[model samples]
Target chain A: MLTLHNYFRSSTSTRLRAALNLKGLDYDYKAYALLKKETQTPDFLARSPAGLVPVLELDDGTALSQSLAIIEYLEEEYPDPPLLPADARGRARVRALAYMIACEVHPLNNLRVLQYLATQFDQDDQGKAAWFNHWVHQTFRPLEALLADSPETGRYCHGDTPGLADCCLYAQIWNNRRFKVDSSPYPTIERIFAALDELEPFRKAAPPEQPDAT
Target chain B: MLTLHNYFRSSTSTRLRAALNLKGLDYDYKAYALLKKETQTPDFLARSPAGLVPVLELDDGTALSQSLAIIEYLEEEYPDPPLLPADARGRARVRALAYMIACEVHPLNNLRVLQYLATQFDQDDQGKAAWFNHWVHQTFRPLEALLADSPETGRYCHGDTPGLADCCLYAQIWNNRRFKVDSSPYPTIERIFAALDELEPFRKAAPPEQPDAT
Candidate 1:
């Protein structure tokens, strides 16, 4: 059996969980408390060298970190209900949409980056929230524009079927709710999130539905 | 020929340039001066919705954003010198290695993020440099550890052939030089980078070797 080492509230973890659920793959859930520094322990470090969550341990004990990479692995290993598009160009479009949120927004607003801002720059809670919201809006504006403008966009980020970009978008919207970011500005994004929320796979992957949710 | 809208010094652009070089693909280099807010221009934003560097424009006028996604598109379209591994596990390992640098390091230390630190938090050059180095080490230490400890690591990030992870690793080392980061702590990384530097594909794709480099 596989074991998923992650925290419930982590956006990356949420993305991976949705991917796993979408694939109909089951795994043991191992929770790590990020605030308590549980991932920094030697054991967790052995599993994930970066000491970050969403480490997908295979049956052979080969631990794979990086949520996007893990999702790609699952996509490859389990092709049914594919997360990525079949065509290369379509795949590129979906992956590009996914990376826009994964790379541009989430990395800047993740817990560690926020903590670093608070500690290193002495940014207060309001300042941190501002920083988070700033990045969110920065990327979300263009993301919304792209989605709204593109004929390729359907009920989800790509087509009527939910895939990789949907996974990223769904996870990010949940992360935004914690910070109380206004989704009213991105109607396309909001509509997609609502559509995804209606699905069982995405609903089950929500932070509140997780075993370790606070 | 593809049109690559990018900056010479951007780490993501460096990685894509190296990949295109590896694949022996020619592109019309359209330089975006990030510091001058050139990428934020309406013209550039039309090419890339996020206004980010390294947008690969296909001949059909389809613009692909995100360096990794573009590289993957190239890998699928031009599989002569494959950028990823043959097997699922191997591909996962390589992608994980690549994402470690791409998602974790580059996003945090990019030009815009540093400008944000300086403007938003009143961080001086010294503070920005410190912030940059701090992120580099945070990911590099674990990256070095993973590369050093893994038996799968060969001359490059994966096997003897330079691929996706190698492109990311090679570009990041170049980015580090500007920040004057100490590479002594990561001997394996430095050694692999040295090996890669000897290759024309990587050397020609370097920041100093770019047509728009100033």
Candidate 2:
């Protein structure tokens, strides 16, 4: 069986969990609390050199990290209930949408980045909130424009089916709500997210529904 | 024909250019100088909602953004002189290595981010350099560990061939050198970079070789 090493509230982990559920693949879950620095432990570091959570260990002892890479692997290996689109251009659009959130927005607001800003730069709670919200807006504005203007956008970020982009969008929207980011500016995202929330896979993979959620 | 709208010094642009060259594909180069904030203009923003380079505009007018996604699209569409390994797990390893540099390190040291540190946090040049080098070390340490330990590592990040991981590694190492980051720490990365440097495709794709380089 596949084993997933992840934290309940981690956005990347949530995305991977939803992808796995959507693919109907069962996996063992291993939880690590980021607040406690569990990922930095020597043993965990042995499994993942990056010391990040949401590592998927294969049955043959190979471990995979990075949520996007892991998802791509799953898409290639499983190839059912596909997370990516069939055509190359459609796949590029989906991947670009996913990267807009994962690489651009999420990286800036990651827990480690926030801590660095606080301890190194002396940012107060309000300052931290502003920093978080600033990136959210910067990314969401373009994202909103893309979704609103693109003819390819149907029930999801791509066509009618929910795929890789939706997984990332759902996870990011959840984080946006947690950080109290105003969603009023992004009606397209809010509408698509609302649709995704009703799905069994997405509902089952939500942070609050996780076994280790606080 | 393909048209790439990219800044010469942008690492992501460099990587994509190398990928295109490796596939023996020719393209029209539209240079945008990042230091001049060319990416923020209205026309560019219409094509790329993210307002970033390198935007790969296809013949049919489908503009693709984000270097990784664009590269993936090329890999799928072109397929010859493949930038990915044959097996699924091998592709995952290469992608993870690439993302480790792209998503983790490059985002932290991006031009806009460095500008934010200077303006918002009152960071001086020294402080900014420290911030940049800190992330470089943080990422390279684990990266060095991963590359040195894995037997799959050949002349490149994977077996014998320079693929997606090498493209990212080459770009990042160039940035490291530009910022005077000490390369003594990552012998494996240095070694692979040296090998890549000797290749015509990589050499042709260097930032200095771009039409916009001043």
Q: Pick the candidate with the highest lDDT.
A: 1
Candidate-wise lDDT, in order? 0.93, 0.92
lDDT of 1 by residue, A1-214 (tens): 8899999999999999999999999999999999999999999998888999999999999899899999998988899999888899999999999999999999999999999999999999999999999999999999999899999899999989999999999999999999999999899999999999999999999999999898
Q: Give candidate 1's error at residue B172 in angstroms.
A: 0.8
C-alpha lDDT of residue A28 in model 2: 95
Residue B204 in candidate 1 has what lDDT?
93
Where is model 1 chain A poorest over a 10-residue stretch in terms of lDDT? A76-85
Model 1's alpha-carbon lDDT is 0.93
Q: Give per-model CA RMSD.
A: 0.8, 0.9
Off by over 4 Å in 2: none
Residue A12, model 1: Cα distance from true site in angstroms: 0.4
Best by DockQ: 1
Cα miss at A54, model 2 (Å)? 1.0
